[model samples]
Target: MIPVTRRIAIDERELSETFVRASGPGGQNVNKVSTAVELRFDVAGSPNLPEEVRQRLARLAGRRLTLDGVLVLRADRFRTQERNREDALERLLGLIREAAVPPPPPRKATKPTRSSQIKRVDEKKRRGNVKGLRRGRIDHD
Candidate 1:
Protein backbone atom coordinates (compact mmCIF):
# COMPACT_ATOMS: atom_id res chain seq x y z
CA MET A 1 0.00 0.00 0.00
CA ILE A 2 1.22 3.51 -0.83
CA PRO A 3 0.31 5.96 1.91
CA VAL A 4 -0.94 9.20 0.41
CA THR A 5 -2.32 10.62 3.61
CA ARG A 6 -3.28 9.53 7.09
CA ARG A 7 -6.66 8.30 5.87
CA ILE A 8 -5.86 7.61 2.22
CA ALA A 9 -3.75 4.67 1.12
CA ILE A 10 -3.45 3.32 -2.41
CA ASP A 11 -2.83 -0.29 -3.41
CA GLU A 12 0.29 -0.89 -5.49
CA ARG A 13 -1.75 -3.02 -7.85
CA GLU A 14 -3.91 -0.02 -8.65
CA LEU A 15 -1.05 1.55 -10.62
CA SER A 16 0.31 0.40 -14.00
CA GLU A 17 3.57 1.53 -15.61
CA THR A 18 4.61 1.38 -19.25
CA PHE A 19 8.00 2.23 -20.70
CA VAL A 20 8.39 4.06 -24.01
CA ARG A 21 11.17 5.68 -25.98
CA ALA A 22 12.01 9.18 -24.80
CA SER A 23 12.33 12.05 -27.24
CA GLY A 24 14.89 14.91 -27.22
CA PRO A 25 18.66 14.82 -26.96
CA GLY A 26 20.18 11.74 -25.32
CA GLY A 27 22.65 10.71 -28.01
CA GLN A 28 22.11 7.36 -29.82
CA ASN A 29 21.31 5.60 -26.51
CA VAL A 30 17.87 7.30 -26.46
CA ASN A 31 16.90 5.44 -29.66
CA LYS A 32 18.01 2.08 -28.28
CA VAL A 33 16.45 2.29 -24.79
CA SER A 34 12.90 2.94 -23.65
CA THR A 35 13.75 5.28 -20.76
CA ALA A 36 10.47 7.14 -20.41
CA VAL A 37 7.83 5.89 -18.00
CA GLU A 38 4.10 6.31 -18.40
CA LEU A 39 2.28 5.87 -15.12
CA ARG A 40 -1.46 5.30 -15.15
CA PHE A 41 -4.00 5.45 -12.31
CA ASP A 42 -7.71 4.65 -12.63
CA VAL A 43 -9.24 7.57 -10.82
CA ALA A 44 -12.89 6.90 -11.71
CA GLY A 45 -12.91 3.22 -10.83
CA SER A 46 -10.52 3.21 -7.89
CA PRO A 47 -12.19 2.24 -4.62
CA ASN A 48 -9.18 3.50 -2.67
CA LEU A 49 -9.82 7.21 -3.33
CA PRO A 50 -12.57 9.07 -1.49
CA GLU A 51 -15.33 10.55 -3.64
CA GLU A 52 -14.26 14.10 -2.78
CA VAL A 53 -10.63 13.36 -3.61
CA ARG A 54 -11.67 11.64 -6.80
CA GLN A 55 -13.59 14.72 -7.90
CA ARG A 56 -10.66 16.96 -6.98
CA LEU A 57 -8.26 14.62 -8.75
CA ALA A 58 -10.38 14.70 -11.86
CA ARG A 59 -10.34 18.48 -11.80
CA LEU A 60 -6.60 18.63 -11.16
CA ALA A 61 -5.80 15.94 -13.67
CA GLY A 62 -7.15 18.14 -16.49
CA ARG A 63 -5.87 16.88 -19.89
CA ARG A 64 -3.89 14.18 -18.12
CA LEU A 65 -7.13 12.32 -17.44
CA THR A 66 -8.33 10.30 -20.39
CA LEU A 67 -11.96 9.53 -21.40
CA ASP A 68 -11.53 6.18 -19.70
CA GLY A 69 -10.83 8.10 -16.43
CA VAL A 70 -7.20 7.05 -16.26
CA LEU A 71 -4.69 9.61 -15.04
CA VAL A 72 -1.49 9.38 -17.13
CA LEU A 73 1.78 10.89 -16.00
CA ARG A 74 4.82 10.61 -18.21
CA ALA A 75 8.32 10.94 -16.78
CA ASP A 76 11.34 11.29 -19.09
CA ARG A 77 13.56 13.85 -17.38
CA PHE A 78 16.04 11.13 -16.50
CA ARG A 79 18.20 9.17 -18.92
CA THR A 80 17.82 5.80 -17.23
CA GLN A 81 14.64 3.71 -17.12
CA GLU A 82 14.96 3.13 -13.37
CA ARG A 83 15.21 6.84 -12.65
CA ASN A 84 12.28 7.59 -14.93
CA ARG A 85 10.21 4.87 -13.27
CA GLU A 86 10.96 6.27 -9.83
CA ASP A 87 10.19 9.78 -11.07
CA ALA A 88 6.83 8.63 -12.41
CA LEU A 89 5.91 6.86 -9.18
CA GLU A 90 6.97 9.88 -7.11
CA ARG A 91 4.89 12.16 -9.32
CA LEU A 92 1.88 9.83 -8.97
CA LEU A 93 2.21 9.88 -5.19
CA GLY A 94 2.52 13.64 -5.24
CA LEU A 95 -0.66 14.02 -7.25
CA ILE A 96 -2.58 11.68 -4.95
CA ARG A 97 -1.26 13.50 -1.88
CA GLU A 98 -2.33 16.81 -3.34
CA ALA A 99 -5.82 15.47 -4.06
CA ALA A 100 -6.13 14.04 -0.56
CA VAL A 101 -5.85 17.50 0.99
CA PRO A 102 -9.15 19.30 1.70
CA PRO A 103 -10.00 22.45 -0.18
CA PRO A 104 -9.30 25.73 1.56
CA PRO A 105 -12.12 27.73 3.15
CA PRO A 106 -13.83 30.18 0.84
CA ARG A 107 -12.78 33.81 1.17
CA LYS A 108 -15.29 36.09 2.90
CA ALA A 109 -16.56 38.87 0.64
CA THR A 110 -15.53 42.25 2.00
CA LYS A 111 -16.84 45.73 1.22
CA PRO A 112 -14.44 48.59 0.64
CA THR A 113 -13.74 50.65 3.79
CA ARG A 114 -15.40 54.08 4.04
CA SER A 115 -12.02 55.83 3.83
CA SER A 116 -10.98 53.76 0.81
CA GLN A 117 -14.29 54.44 -0.94
CA ILE A 118 -13.86 58.15 -0.29
CA LYS A 119 -10.30 58.02 -1.57
CA ARG A 120 -11.35 56.19 -4.69
CA VAL A 121 -14.10 58.73 -5.40
CA ASP A 122 -11.67 61.57 -4.72
CA GLU A 123 -9.13 60.09 -7.16
CA LYS A 124 -11.82 59.68 -9.80
CA LYS A 125 -12.97 63.23 -9.31
CA ARG A 126 -9.39 64.46 -9.54
CA ARG A 127 -8.91 62.52 -12.79
CA GLY A 128 -12.20 63.90 -14.13
CA ASN A 129 -11.08 67.42 -13.23
CA VAL A 130 -7.79 66.90 -15.09
CA LYS A 131 -9.69 65.70 -18.17
CA GLY A 132 -12.25 68.46 -17.83
CA LEU A 133 -9.44 71.04 -17.86
CA ARG A 134 -8.26 69.60 -21.18
CA ARG A 135 -11.36 70.99 -22.91
CA GLY A 136 -10.47 74.04 -25.12
CA ARG A 137 -11.57 77.51 -23.91
CA ILE A 138 -14.86 78.69 -25.48
CA ASP A 139 -14.73 81.74 -27.79
CA HIS A 140 -16.84 84.70 -26.51
CA ASP A 141 -16.75 86.68 -29.81
Candidate 2:
Protein backbone atom coordinates (compact mmCIF):
# COMPACT_ATOMS: atom_id res chain seq x y z
CA MET A 1 0.00 0.00 0.00
CA ILE A 2 1.12 3.57 -0.79
CA PRO A 3 0.34 6.13 1.88
CA VAL A 4 -0.41 9.57 0.51
CA THR A 5 -1.18 11.13 3.87
CA ARG A 6 -2.32 10.08 7.30
CA ARG A 7 -5.88 9.92 5.98
CA ILE A 8 -5.33 8.70 2.44
CA ALA A 9 -3.78 5.46 1.16
CA ILE A 10 -3.58 3.57 -2.15
CA ASP A 11 -3.03 -0.07 -3.11
CA GLU A 12 0.30 -0.91 -4.65
CA ARG A 13 -1.53 -2.94 -7.29
CA GLU A 14 -3.16 0.26 -8.44
CA LEU A 15 0.23 1.28 -9.82
CA SER A 16 1.75 -0.26 -12.98
CA GLU A 17 5.44 -0.09 -13.74
CA THR A 18 7.20 -0.64 -17.06
CA PHE A 19 10.92 -0.57 -17.63
CA VAL A 20 12.64 0.88 -20.71
CA ARG A 21 16.09 2.00 -21.80
CA ALA A 22 17.39 5.08 -20.01
CA SER A 23 19.38 7.64 -21.94
CA GLY A 24 22.42 9.38 -20.38
CA PRO A 25 25.37 8.25 -18.13
CA GLY A 26 25.45 4.47 -18.82
CA GLY A 27 27.43 4.48 -22.13
CA GLN A 28 26.60 1.45 -24.38
CA ASN A 29 24.71 -0.23 -21.51
CA VAL A 30 22.23 2.65 -21.66
CA ASN A 31 21.13 1.51 -25.12
CA LYS A 32 20.88 -2.19 -24.22
CA VAL A 33 19.41 -2.26 -20.69
CA SER A 34 15.88 -1.13 -19.88
CA THR A 35 16.36 0.69 -16.56
CA ALA A 36 13.92 3.60 -16.96
CA VAL A 37 10.63 3.32 -15.13
CA GLU A 38 7.29 4.34 -16.59
CA LEU A 39 4.72 4.32 -13.83
CA ARG A 40 1.01 4.51 -14.57
CA PHE A 41 -1.85 5.02 -12.13
CA ASP A 42 -5.54 5.28 -12.96
CA VAL A 43 -6.97 8.19 -10.99
CA ALA A 44 -10.45 8.50 -12.46
CA GLY A 45 -11.97 5.08 -11.98
CA SER A 46 -9.92 4.02 -8.99
CA PRO A 47 -11.82 2.73 -5.95
CA ASN A 48 -9.11 3.70 -3.48
CA LEU A 49 -9.35 7.50 -3.85
CA PRO A 50 -12.26 9.67 -2.77
CA GLU A 51 -14.33 11.50 -5.39
CA GLU A 52 -13.00 14.91 -4.33
CA VAL A 53 -9.44 13.58 -4.32
CA ARG A 54 -9.95 12.04 -7.76
CA GLN A 55 -11.25 15.35 -9.09
CA ARG A 56 -8.37 17.30 -7.58
CA LEU A 57 -5.86 14.72 -8.78
CA ALA A 58 -7.19 14.91 -12.32
CA ARG A 59 -6.83 18.69 -12.49
CA LEU A 60 -3.52 18.72 -10.63
CA ALA A 61 -1.96 15.94 -12.72
CA GLY A 62 -1.37 18.27 -15.72
CA ARG A 63 0.29 16.55 -18.75
CA ARG A 64 1.03 13.45 -16.69
CA LEU A 65 -2.51 12.14 -17.10
CA THR A 66 -3.27 10.48 -20.39
CA LEU A 67 -6.49 10.76 -22.40
CA ASP A 68 -7.66 7.50 -20.84
CA GLY A 69 -7.26 9.07 -17.36
CA VAL A 70 -4.09 7.15 -16.57
CA LEU A 71 -1.51 9.09 -14.58
CA VAL A 72 1.88 8.54 -16.25
CA LEU A 73 5.23 9.31 -14.64
CA ARG A 74 8.63 8.72 -16.22
CA ALA A 75 11.53 8.11 -13.86
CA ASP A 76 14.86 8.08 -15.67
CA ARG A 77 17.04 10.33 -13.54
CA PHE A 78 18.49 7.30 -11.76
CA ARG A 79 20.28 4.45 -13.57
CA THR A 80 18.76 1.43 -11.78
CA GLN A 81 15.14 0.34 -12.07
CA GLU A 82 14.76 0.12 -8.29
CA ARG A 83 15.89 3.72 -7.80
CA ASN A 84 13.69 4.88 -10.67
CA ARG A 85 10.77 2.92 -9.28
CA GLU A 86 11.17 4.56 -5.86
CA ASP A 87 11.52 7.94 -7.54
CA ALA A 88 8.27 7.42 -9.42
CA LEU A 89 6.46 6.34 -6.26
CA GLU A 90 7.86 9.37 -4.41
CA ARG A 91 6.57 11.68 -7.12
CA LEU A 92 3.15 10.07 -7.00
CA LEU A 93 3.01 10.38 -3.23
CA GLY A 94 4.16 14.00 -3.44
CA LEU A 95 1.42 14.85 -5.90
CA ILE A 96 -1.26 13.11 -3.85
CA ARG A 97 0.05 14.65 -0.62
CA GLU A 98 -0.16 18.12 -2.12
CA ALA A 99 -3.82 17.55 -2.94
CA ALA A 100 -4.68 15.86 0.36
CA VAL A 101 -5.10 19.12 2.24
CA PRO A 102 -8.31 21.12 1.88
CA PRO A 103 -8.12 24.22 -0.25
CA PRO A 104 -8.21 27.70 1.33
CA PRO A 105 -11.59 29.28 1.94
CA PRO A 106 -13.02 31.50 -0.76
CA ARG A 107 -12.43 35.21 -0.21
CA LYS A 108 -15.41 37.35 0.76
CA ALA A 109 -16.52 39.86 -1.87
CA THR A 110 -15.28 43.34 -1.05
CA LYS A 111 -15.85 46.84 -2.40
CA PRO A 112 -12.98 49.23 -2.93
CA THR A 113 -12.33 51.45 0.07
CA ARG A 114 -13.20 55.11 -0.49
CA SER A 115 -9.72 56.22 0.56
CA SER A 116 -8.06 53.72 -1.78
CA GLN A 117 -10.31 54.77 -4.65
CA ILE A 118 -9.48 58.39 -4.02
CA LYS A 119 -5.79 57.56 -3.88
CA ARG A 120 -6.04 55.68 -7.16
CA VAL A 121 -7.81 58.62 -8.74
CA ASP A 122 -5.16 60.98 -7.38
CA GLU A 123 -2.37 58.81 -8.76
CA LYS A 124 -4.03 58.63 -12.15
CA LYS A 125 -4.47 62.41 -12.18
CA ARG A 126 -0.78 62.85 -11.28
CA ARG A 127 0.23 60.47 -14.06
CA GLY A 128 -1.98 62.30 -16.54
CA ASN A 129 -0.47 65.64 -15.52
CA VAL A 130 3.06 64.31 -16.04
CA LYS A 131 2.06 62.98 -19.47
CA GLY A 132 0.29 66.25 -20.35
CA LEU A 133 3.38 68.32 -19.40
CA ARG A 134 5.52 66.38 -21.92
CA ARG A 135 3.62 67.88 -24.86
CA GLY A 136 5.50 70.77 -26.56
CA ARG A 137 4.21 74.30 -25.82
CA ILE A 138 1.24 75.21 -28.03
CA ASP A 139 1.47 77.99 -30.61
CA HIS A 140 -0.28 81.30 -29.76
CA ASP A 141 -3.75 81.61 -31.31
Candidate 3:
Protein backbone atom coordinates (compact mmCIF):
# COMPACT_ATOMS: atom_id res chain seq x y z
CA MET A 1 0.00 0.00 0.00
CA ILE A 2 1.21 3.50 -0.84
CA PRO A 3 0.20 6.16 1.64
CA VAL A 4 -0.53 9.39 -0.19
CA THR A 5 -1.85 11.30 2.79
CA ARG A 6 -3.30 10.79 6.25
CA ARG A 7 -6.64 9.86 4.69
CA ILE A 8 -5.61 8.30 1.38
CA ALA A 9 -3.72 5.07 0.77
CA ILE A 10 -3.35 3.34 -2.59
CA ASP A 11 -3.25 -0.42 -2.97
CA GLU A 12 -0.02 -1.79 -4.48
CA ARG A 13 -2.11 -3.99 -6.80
CA GLU A 14 -3.43 -0.88 -8.54
CA LEU A 15 0.01 -0.08 -9.96
CA SER A 16 1.57 -1.68 -13.04
CA GLU A 17 5.19 -1.40 -14.15
CA THR A 18 7.08 -2.37 -17.29
CA PHE A 19 10.77 -2.14 -18.16
CA VAL A 20 12.34 -1.26 -21.50
CA ARG A 21 15.84 -0.49 -22.81
CA ALA A 22 17.03 3.04 -22.05
CA SER A 23 19.06 5.22 -24.39
CA GLY A 24 22.33 7.18 -23.67
CA PRO A 25 25.40 7.04 -21.32
CA GLY A 26 25.42 3.33 -20.42
CA GLY A 27 27.41 2.26 -23.52
CA GLN A 28 27.27 -1.53 -24.20
CA ASN A 29 25.22 -2.23 -21.04
CA VAL A 30 22.47 0.08 -22.31
CA ASN A 31 21.93 -2.13 -25.37
CA LYS A 32 21.75 -5.34 -23.28
CA VAL A 33 19.79 -4.28 -20.18
CA SER A 34 16.34 -2.74 -19.85
CA THR A 35 16.71 0.03 -17.24
CA ALA A 36 13.78 2.32 -18.02
CA VAL A 37 10.65 1.90 -15.91
CA GLU A 38 7.17 2.71 -17.10
CA LEU A 39 4.78 3.09 -14.22
CA ARG A 40 1.03 3.16 -14.82
CA PHE A 41 -1.81 3.92 -12.44
CA ASP A 42 -5.52 3.81 -13.20
CA VAL A 43 -6.49 7.22 -11.84
CA ALA A 44 -10.10 7.21 -13.04
CA GLY A 45 -10.83 3.75 -11.67
CA SER A 46 -8.90 3.96 -8.41
CA PRO A 47 -11.10 3.30 -5.39
CA ASN A 48 -8.53 4.96 -3.12
CA LEU A 49 -8.97 8.47 -4.50
CA PRO A 50 -11.81 10.91 -3.77
CA GLU A 51 -13.85 12.15 -6.76
CA GLU A 52 -12.46 15.68 -6.42
CA VAL A 53 -8.88 14.41 -6.20
CA ARG A 54 -9.45 12.23 -9.26
CA GLN A 55 -10.59 15.26 -11.28
CA ARG A 56 -7.60 17.31 -10.13
CA LEU A 57 -5.23 14.45 -10.89
CA ALA A 58 -6.63 14.23 -14.40
CA ARG A 59 -6.11 17.95 -14.90
CA LEU A 60 -2.59 17.80 -13.44
CA ALA A 61 -1.60 14.74 -15.43
CA GLY A 62 -2.32 16.55 -18.74
CA ARG A 63 -0.48 14.73 -21.58
CA ARG A 64 0.71 12.05 -19.16
CA LEU A 65 -2.81 10.67 -18.81
CA THR A 66 -3.90 8.26 -21.53
CA LEU A 67 -7.34 8.21 -23.21
CA ASP A 68 -8.11 5.07 -21.17
CA GLY A 69 -7.67 7.09 -17.92
CA VAL A 70 -4.30 5.60 -16.97
CA LEU A 71 -1.55 7.87 -15.64
CA VAL A 72 1.80 6.85 -17.14
CA LEU A 73 5.16 7.98 -15.76
CA ARG A 74 8.47 7.13 -17.39
CA ALA A 75 11.68 6.97 -15.33
CA ASP A 76 14.96 6.64 -17.17
CA ARG A 77 17.28 8.99 -15.34
CA PHE A 78 19.06 6.15 -13.54
CA ARG A 79 21.09 3.43 -15.28
CA THR A 80 20.02 0.57 -13.00
CA GLN A 81 16.58 -1.04 -13.05
CA GLU A 82 16.08 -0.76 -9.29
CA ARG A 83 16.98 2.93 -9.21
CA ASN A 84 14.70 3.66 -12.14
CA ARG A 85 11.87 1.67 -10.52
CA GLU A 86 12.24 3.57 -7.25
CA ASP A 87 12.35 6.86 -9.14
CA ALA A 88 9.11 5.96 -10.92
CA LEU A 89 7.35 5.00 -7.66
CA GLU A 90 8.57 8.16 -5.92
CA ARG A 91 7.28 10.30 -8.79
CA LEU A 92 3.92 8.51 -8.64
CA LEU A 93 3.64 9.15 -4.93
CA GLY A 94 4.54 12.81 -5.40
CA LEU A 95 1.80 13.19 -7.99
CA ILE A 96 -0.78 11.53 -5.74
CA ARG A 97 0.28 13.71 -2.82
CA GLU A 98 -0.15 16.78 -4.98
CA ALA A 99 -3.63 15.66 -5.98
CA ALA A 100 -4.56 15.13 -2.33
CA VAL A 101 -4.12 18.84 -1.61
CA PRO A 102 -7.28 20.97 -1.58
CA PRO A 103 -7.62 23.52 -4.34
CA PRO A 104 -7.52 27.24 -3.53
CA PRO A 105 -10.77 29.14 -3.11
CA PRO A 106 -12.20 30.80 -6.22
CA ARG A 107 -11.41 34.52 -6.59
CA LYS A 108 -14.25 36.86 -5.62
CA ALA A 109 -15.55 39.12 -8.37
CA THR A 110 -14.92 42.86 -7.81
CA LYS A 111 -15.66 46.13 -9.54
CA PRO A 112 -13.64 49.38 -9.53
CA THR A 113 -14.73 51.89 -6.89
CA ARG A 114 -16.38 55.10 -8.17
CA SER A 115 -13.51 57.24 -6.85
CA SER A 116 -10.89 55.03 -8.55
CA GLN A 117 -12.80 55.13 -11.82
CA ILE A 118 -13.04 58.94 -11.64
CA LYS A 119 -9.32 59.16 -10.83
CA ARG A 120 -8.46 56.99 -13.89
CA VAL A 121 -10.59 59.24 -16.15
CA ASP A 122 -8.98 62.29 -14.61
CA GLU A 123 -5.50 60.99 -15.33
CA LYS A 124 -6.46 60.24 -18.96
CA LYS A 125 -7.85 63.76 -19.38
CA ARG A 126 -4.66 65.26 -17.90
CA ARG A 127 -2.52 63.26 -20.34
CA GLY A 128 -4.75 64.33 -23.25
CA ASN A 129 -4.40 67.99 -22.24
CA VAL A 130 -0.59 67.67 -22.12
CA LYS A 131 -0.59 66.13 -25.64
CA GLY A 132 -2.96 68.85 -26.92
CA LEU A 133 -0.58 71.57 -25.60
CA ARG A 134 2.30 69.96 -27.57
CA ARG A 135 0.56 70.76 -30.93
CA GLY A 136 1.41 74.28 -32.34
CA ARG A 137 -1.67 76.46 -33.14
CA ILE A 138 -2.22 77.17 -36.87
CA ASP A 139 -3.02 80.82 -37.86
CA HIS A 140 -6.05 80.81 -40.25
CA ASP A 141 -5.99 84.38 -41.73
Candidate 4:
Protein backbone atom coordinates (compact mmCIF):
# COMPACT_ATOMS: atom_id res chain seq x y z
CA MET A 1 0.00 0.00 0.00
CA ILE A 2 1.24 3.50 -0.84
CA PRO A 3 0.46 5.98 1.90
CA VAL A 4 -0.90 9.28 0.66
CA THR A 5 -1.99 10.94 3.87
CA ARG A 6 -2.22 9.60 7.42
CA ARG A 7 -5.74 8.39 6.74
CA ILE A 8 -5.53 7.65 3.02
CA ALA A 9 -3.66 4.64 1.63
CA ILE A 10 -3.58 3.39 -1.94
CA ASP A 11 -3.33 -0.23 -3.00
CA GLU A 12 -0.39 -0.79 -5.32
CA ARG A 13 -2.37 -3.18 -7.50
CA GLU A 14 -4.59 -0.31 -8.60
CA LEU A 15 -1.65 1.36 -10.29
CA SER A 16 -0.36 0.35 -13.75
CA GLU A 17 3.13 1.14 -15.01
CA THR A 18 4.63 1.09 -18.46
CA PHE A 19 8.23 1.77 -19.43
CA VAL A 20 9.06 3.53 -22.68
CA ARG A 21 11.95 5.30 -24.36
CA ALA A 22 12.47 8.85 -23.13
CA SER A 23 12.79 11.71 -25.59
CA GLY A 24 15.12 14.74 -25.59
CA PRO A 25 18.71 15.04 -24.25
CA GLY A 26 19.33 11.42 -23.20
CA GLY A 27 22.40 11.32 -25.54
CA GLN A 28 23.39 7.77 -26.49
CA ASN A 29 21.12 6.37 -23.71
CA VAL A 30 18.08 7.94 -25.38
CA ASN A 31 17.91 5.22 -28.04
CA LYS A 32 19.28 2.32 -25.99
CA VAL A 33 17.39 2.46 -22.67
CA SER A 34 13.72 2.56 -21.71
CA THR A 35 13.99 4.43 -18.43
CA ALA A 36 10.83 6.52 -18.61
CA VAL A 37 8.07 5.41 -16.29
CA GLU A 38 4.47 6.02 -17.23
CA LEU A 39 2.26 5.53 -14.21
CA ARG A 40 -1.49 5.47 -14.75
CA PHE A 41 -4.10 5.58 -12.02
CA ASP A 42 -7.76 5.19 -12.83
CA VAL A 43 -9.22 7.88 -10.67
CA ALA A 44 -12.83 7.10 -11.61
CA GLY A 45 -12.62 3.36 -10.94
CA SER A 46 -10.39 3.21 -7.88
CA PRO A 47 -12.15 1.95 -4.79
CA ASN A 48 -9.22 2.65 -2.50
CA LEU A 49 -9.57 6.43 -2.73
CA PRO A 50 -12.70 7.98 -1.30
CA GLU A 51 -15.13 9.78 -3.64
CA GLU A 52 -14.24 13.20 -2.26
CA VAL A 53 -10.54 12.51 -2.59
CA ARG A 54 -11.01 11.21 -6.11
CA GLN A 55 -12.91 14.36 -7.09
CA ARG A 56 -10.22 16.55 -5.59
CA LEU A 57 -7.49 14.48 -7.17
CA ALA A 58 -9.06 14.75 -10.58
CA ARG A 59 -9.29 18.52 -10.22
CA LEU A 60 -5.76 18.76 -8.89
CA ALA A 61 -4.40 16.53 -11.64
CA GLY A 62 -5.63 19.00 -14.29
CA ARG A 63 -3.92 17.97 -17.58
CA ARG A 64 -2.55 14.79 -16.04
CA LEU A 65 -6.02 13.31 -15.95
CA THR A 66 -7.07 12.17 -19.41
CA LEU A 67 -10.60 12.04 -20.80
CA ASP A 68 -10.82 8.37 -19.84
CA GLY A 69 -10.17 9.32 -16.20
CA VAL A 70 -6.62 8.03 -16.17
CA LEU A 71 -4.05 10.11 -14.30
CA VAL A 72 -0.74 9.61 -16.13
CA LEU A 73 2.65 10.74 -14.90
CA ARG A 74 5.97 10.44 -16.71
CA ALA A 75 9.25 10.09 -14.85
CA ASP A 76 12.60 10.10 -16.64
CA ARG A 77 14.92 12.25 -14.60
CA PHE A 78 16.80 9.27 -13.13
CA ARG A 79 19.20 7.03 -15.07
CA THR A 80 17.89 3.69 -13.83
CA GLN A 81 14.38 2.54 -14.61
CA GLU A 82 13.90 1.46 -10.99
CA ARG A 83 14.72 4.93 -9.66
CA ASN A 84 12.46 6.50 -12.26
CA ARG A 85 9.71 4.12 -11.22
CA GLU A 86 10.11 5.13 -7.60
CA ASP A 87 10.13 8.77 -8.60
CA ALA A 88 6.82 8.34 -10.45
CA LEU A 89 5.23 6.56 -7.50
CA GLU A 90 6.44 9.30 -5.14
CA ARG A 91 4.93 11.96 -7.39
CA LEU A 92 1.62 10.12 -7.40
CA LEU A 93 1.69 9.86 -3.62
CA GLY A 94 2.49 13.54 -3.31
CA LEU A 95 -0.38 14.53 -5.62
CA ILE A 96 -2.90 12.49 -3.67
CA ARG A 97 -1.50 13.78 -0.40
CA GLU A 98 -2.15 17.31 -1.55
CA ALA A 99 -5.70 16.44 -2.62
CA ALA A 100 -6.42 14.56 0.62
CA VAL A 101 -6.24 17.79 2.60
CA PRO A 102 -9.72 19.07 3.46
CA PRO A 103 -10.43 22.36 1.77
CA PRO A 104 -11.17 25.41 3.89
CA PRO A 105 -14.77 26.48 4.30
CA PRO A 106 -16.21 29.12 2.02
CA ARG A 107 -16.00 32.67 3.35
CA LYS A 108 -19.12 34.77 3.66
CA ALA A 109 -19.10 37.98 1.67
CA THR A 110 -19.33 41.33 3.47
CA LYS A 111 -19.95 44.88 2.28
CA PRO A 112 -17.16 47.46 2.35
CA THR A 113 -17.08 50.04 5.18
CA ARG A 114 -18.73 53.44 4.61
CA SER A 115 -15.38 55.20 4.99
CA SER A 116 -13.79 52.98 2.35
CA GLN A 117 -16.65 53.70 -0.07
CA ILE A 118 -16.26 57.48 0.50
CA LYS A 119 -12.45 57.23 0.01
CA ARG A 120 -12.93 55.25 -3.23
CA VAL A 121 -15.29 57.91 -4.58
CA ASP A 122 -12.88 60.63 -3.53
CA GLU A 123 -10.02 58.89 -5.34
CA LYS A 124 -12.14 58.50 -8.46
CA LYS A 125 -13.03 62.20 -8.37
CA ARG A 126 -9.37 63.18 -7.95
CA ARG A 127 -8.38 60.98 -10.90
CA GLY A 128 -11.18 62.52 -12.94
CA ASN A 129 -9.90 66.04 -12.17
CA VAL A 130 -6.33 65.04 -13.14
CA LYS A 131 -7.45 63.56 -16.46
CA GLY A 132 -9.86 66.49 -17.02
CA LEU A 133 -6.86 68.80 -17.28
CA ARG A 134 -5.71 66.85 -20.40
CA ARG A 135 -8.87 67.72 -22.30
CA GLY A 136 -8.48 69.68 -25.62
CA ARG A 137 -9.19 73.44 -25.73
CA ILE A 138 -12.50 72.86 -27.60
CA ASP A 139 -13.87 71.22 -24.41
CA HIS A 140 -11.54 72.91 -21.86
CA ASP A 141 -14.03 75.59 -20.75
By TM-score, the better pick of 1 and 2 is 1
Candidate 1 worst ten-residue window by lDDT: 132-141
Q: Residues 16-132, candidate 1, lDDT per residue (tens digit)?
A: 999999999999998899999999999999999999999999999999999999999999999999999999988888888888889899999999999999999988877777776
lDDT per model, in order?
A: 0.91, 0.88, 0.91, 0.90
What TM-score do all the candidates reach, one by one?
A: 0.75, 0.75, 0.76, 0.74
What is model 4's C-alpha RMSD? 5.3
Using TM-score as the yardstick, the better of models 3 and 4 is 3
TM-score of 4: 0.74
- Best-to-worst TM-score order: 3, 1, 2, 4
RMSD of each: 5.4, 5.2, 4.7, 5.3
Clash statistics: count for each candidate = 0, 0, 0, 0
Better of 2 and 3 by TM-score: 3
lDDT of 1: 0.91
